[model samples]
Target: MANTSYTRSEELKEILSGQETQLQQKMDEAKDMASFLVELVDTLEVTMSNRSAKGDKEKPLRYCTHIMEQLDALGWDRVTLVDQDLSRVQIELCDASQRKHLITARFPPAYPTIPLTIAPLEVPECEDDQLASQRGLSVGGLSLKQGLALEAAIRQAEGQLEIFREFWDVMQDFDERTWVIDPEKPTRADKMRRCALGNHCSIQVTVQPLSPRSMPDTKLFGPTASIAPMRTKLYQNAGLWDVKKLPRENLEVLLELEGGFPSPVSTNKDDINVGCGICYSFRFEGQVPDQLCSHAKCQQPFHRVCLYETITTSAPKT
Candidate 1:
């Protein structure tokens, strides 16, 4: 009886091992399918972008339809895409549990060299649910299926970004010595002017509860983007601030900029006293609103309107 019981136990262990092997095989197949789908979608995106750049407007619609059919066949929904100057898409997928999985892809106008960015959506508290199940995965084991799905999205965005970057580089090149030719010499205090194509268009990527990986393995085609966990509103009333003192980080900067008192003068700079320093209150069609010395450096307040009028009126317009 003792011998029989030992043999039965050994047999049970073997059966369990066999089942695990089967399940692992199934998982591997699923992963491969996911990866393939992502690649298909990514390829379509690149082809579409190339067509659009060549002024083939009708091709994009056809490409999109093909992508939609592919996604539909795979049972995906809750995807929203806003294709504008900077091609951005917000993708949300849910499992049977209605657990949200989101990915945001940004394709800037830089064309070819600059890459697209794909970031995961961050749910408020549940960060781990979005990651693949690590229950059976061994050390260094990544879910190829999950990673592939994400890779496809990233590849698509990155490809578009590459296209944009390539075009932008060509436009920036005036000569080897002076690629960025500034017609007017910038003043020392002036904010660095960005390239018209680069600044006016940028791919903004936002993802939530992103997995803490060093970086995605795929080569990015465009400028990289970052998304931080939403921080709690750390606001303090400027009225409570010690104007005579400056906090190292200027914690009260926002409140100072917002203004403690809602003086109609605070809202509109146009009608304020002629020499008053706070002038955001008075805005004409073409005039910039005045800003106060909110920072500790020179807390000398100035009206946005009055300051502009004082400086500009002092200098005759050419």
Candidate 2:
């Protein structure tokens, strides 16, 4: 009886060992840090800029929160937020010439488990200012994936890695002599349109989430003699964005963009002012209101979203 019990125990140990081996193999097959990020960004439609009147400071449950704690321990501060959301954060660095830049990273809806997007902040509208233009555009063009790898290595498996410092260091090290361009990278101009005919037109695209990864990718051909065909083809490419109508070259589209914002559509009914009555700030950033309250006498122009939100939030809690 004693011999039989010992043999059974040994067999159970062997079974556990086999299970461990199988688990290790599965982990080995798992996607690496970079591939995971590409998948995550593609899944989330990670754009450089996303502004909602509502806010982005979403608090994650596990991974991103761990990273945030690590960042706080490292003394890096949160990005100065308009809505005070912690969904995105940054670290500021200055070169020898005192040129300052901000390294910003944003946590997607599913973060930590999915790699965070680490990139420099961009102020495209303010490029005329020497410092402002360069602040978010890094000199080296080092990929965000590489920075994430560096962050992991620096942590040395002690705790969760922090990406902000790694990003800052990489940009500081970039110089003309050290920078080398890789031809295979997706260029800034052609990111949305991948040219197949070799003219940076006749673009191809694939949606990461909505379509199956195994499915054949689709292409959106650029303009020809008349834009009518291109507009018609856009119907097939409706997955490209939320809108169905291709932007018209006619005055309607032009006027919409030009007059996108008029003023504060809704504001503190009491504050009679020339600027946005909601924020009550004189500085408008050259942006006007896209919407106006319908009453002719109460013609308050407002940012479509700002006014909508102001009115929505101000409504009585029923």
Please give the CA lDDT of all the candidate structures.
Answer: 0.33, 0.35
Predicted model with the maximum TM-score: 2
Predict model 2's lDDT versus the native.
Answer: 0.35
Tens-digit lDDT string for candidate 2 (42-119): 433432123232343444345445665656664544334311455566655444344455556565443443455665
**Location of the lowest summed lDDT over 10 successive residues in candidate 1:** 213-222
TM-score of 2: 0.25
- For model 1 the local lDDT of residue 57 reads 33
Error of 1 at 115 (Å): 11
Give the alpha carbon lDDT tens digit for every residue of 111-135 in model 1. 2223445553332221344232333
Model 1 compared with the native: what TM-score?
0.23
Candidate 1 segments exceeding 4 Å error: 1-66, 73-77, 82-300, 303-305, 311-318
The deviation in Å at residue 212 for candidate 2 is 47
